[model samples]
Target: MKRILLTGCAGFIGSNFVKTIASEQTDYEFDIIDALTYAGRKETIQEELNKHSFLQFHHLDIRDSSKIEKLFQERKYEGVIHFAAESHVDNSIKNPNIFVETNVLGTLNLLNASLKLFKENEAFRFVHVSTDEVYGQLTDDEPAFTEENQIKPSSPYSASKASSDLLVQSYYETFGLPTMITRCSNNYGPYQFPEKLIPVMIFKAQAKEKLPVYGDGKNIRDWIYVDDHNKGVWDVFLKGLAGEVYNLGGDSERRNIEVVNIILEHLGRSKELISYVTDRPGHDWRYAMDFSKARKELGWSPTVKFEEGIKKTIDWYLENKTWIEMVKGNNK
Candidate 1:
């Protein structure tokens, strides 16, 4: 069996990936590692953990180099799909050091370990998951950010991700290590942490609490479902050319206000609950993705539209209040 390592998988998109994609790969054995931070909750995947014979969970902080190396030596992983990071821009603003330590240094450790394995196996692959924010904000008239866009990150989170992306590329160029980077737009789906925009709106709107809208709420984001993004990631891992970068987009661009309004309308909440809050520093005005390369190269495009995906997401959060409470309680 082919053994693979998936880092930071107890969180949102990674958890969904484990549930849907990894579970379907019966020939592949997966070793999932997560720091189990406030956002990464093991409970989200407790059902799969109980029944999936091909899956293993490791309570690991990728920042610990020695421990990471030891695990790498033990597992002798043939592939790595790195999803670990301090992803929340707000949290990154509060403390940038952790983002650097975890996103940059932690990825560096993984690259070092994977290099040894790649040399031994000659077929090892390292796929780094990244965000479109690294390309910075886009204007209304500008063409969507493509794989060819230059890096110009505004927030600390995106900056750290860009740093990791560059480091991965350097390894491939210098050491001939097999690596691919997949940059995707915003993701929304079930099991998303309440701190994110979609979940935040859903939770607050249900409670009749004030819905915080940053700035004038016109900032736009291309919203890909987590499933679509993960599928594109898997395609890149399996079929994409080494040293290549791919962009995955949902093809659904919605303004921040539109997203909030959708949730409010769905929940039958009044617009009076909407509260305009001070925007965070370095908040990118807009983000759009042109994923033509991924489509042409891997035959991958998003299957879930925003409107349909949002309804499914909302229904899930409402149906799984127990899971929600469990995840929220851990953050305290």
Candidate 2:
């Protein structure tokens, strides 16, 4: 069986990807490494681990370079899907140090380890997952970001991610380490940490508590379903050219207010629960991605519509109340 190393497999997108791939593909085995951060939960991926003999979970932080290097030296991974990072923008703003350490330095450690391992296995591929926010904010009428867009990150989180992206590209350019980068739009789906917009709204609205809206609630984002994004990532990993970057998007653009209103309607809650709050420092006005390259090259397109995905997401949270509560409790 082909061995694949997946970091952050206990987190939202990583967990979803693990579950989906484990169910769909039987040829490859997975070695999942997660730090079990506030946003990551072992319970989220327990079912997949229990069901799939191909899946193994390791409680290891990517920031630990010695351990990371030792793992690469011990077992040769055919591919590496890197998803471990400090991802919250607000948390990054509060303390950018961890973001730099995890996203930048951690990525460097992985690249170094991969470089050593790649020498032994010539066909090794490294897939670095990133965000569209690395393109910085967009004007109301500005065109969506493409692979050609210059990196101009607006927040500490995006800055750290951008640094990592550049590092990955440099590895491919300098050492010819087979690497591909994928930048995806905002992702929303089941098992998402409740601090994000969709889940936060759902949690607060369910409790009849005030749903805080950052800024005037007019900020826009191109939201991709987490499953769709993960599928795109898998497509890029299998088919993409080395050193190339692919953007993945749902092609669904919606304003912050519109999303909140939709959740209220879904829960039969009042709009009075909506409360406008001060905008975050360096908040990006909008983020949209042009993923035609991924469609044309990888033959991949998002299958879920926003309305359908949103409802499904809401229903998931409603049904998985214990899961969400446990995650929230751990985060606290």
Candidate 3:
């Protein structure tokens, strides 16, 4: 069986990947590592750990180079699906240093280890999962972002991720570490942390509390189901050419306010609950993706439409209130 290392598998997108892609790829043994940060709880993935012998969870921070190196030496991973990073933009503004540490330096450490391990196996693959924010925002008339877009990160979080993306490219260029980068649009579905837009709105609307919408709530974001994004990542890892970058998008774009209104309407809550907050510093105006390359190359396209996906998301959050409290309690 092929041994693979998946970073941040306890978190939202990664956890969905663990429950879906990693679960189905039975021929591979996945060693998942997470720092157990506020967003990543061991409890989130405990069921999968119990169910699958091919899966193992390690409690270790990617920021710790020595530990990462030791783990690399022991496992000699044939492939790496790197999904760990401090992804919250508001939190990144509060503390950019940790974002650099975890997203940039931590990625360097993984690249270093992957380089060494590559000598043993000629086909070692490293897939860097990234975001569309690295291309910055778009004006209303602008076409959707594609692989040709220039790197113009607007937030510290995106800057850090862009830095790591360049590092992966460098390794592929200088030392010939076989790597591919997959930049995806905003993802939502089950297991998303409450701090994000969708869950936050759901929680507030459910509690009959005021929903905080940033600025005018007109900022646009392309939404992809976590499952679709994970499947695209797997496709890029398995079939993408080395040193290439792929864009995976849901093709579903919605305004922030529209999303909030949808949640409120679904919960049978009043729209007056919406409280417009000051715009976040460096908030991107709009984000859209062009995933035609992924569709053409990997035969992959999003299956779940936003209307259906959002309903699923709201229902999941409603049904799994216990999980919401459990994940939040870990942070406290």
Model 1 C-alpha lDDT per residue in residues 152-229, reported as the tens digit of each score = 999999999999999999999999999999999999999998999999999999999999999999999999999999
- lDDT (Cα atoms) of all candidates against the true structure: 0.95, 0.93, 0.94
Ranking of all predicted structures according to lDDT, beginning with the best and ending with the worst: 1, 3, 2
TM-score of each: 0.99, 0.98, 0.99
> Residue 263 lDDT in model 3?
97
Candidate whose lDDT is highest? 1
Which tens-of-lDDT digit does each residue in 233-291 have in candidate 2? 99988999999999999999999999999999999999999999999989999999999
lDDT of 3 by residue, 89-148 (tens): 999999999999999999999999899999989989999999999999998779999999
For model 1, the stretches where C-alpha displacement exceeds 4 angstroms are none
Q: List the residue pairs that clash in candidate 2.
A: none
RMSD, candidate 1, Å: 1.0
Task: Rate residue 268 of model 2 by lDDT.
Answer: 99
Q: Single out the weakest 10-residue window by summed lDDT for candidate 1.
A: 323-332
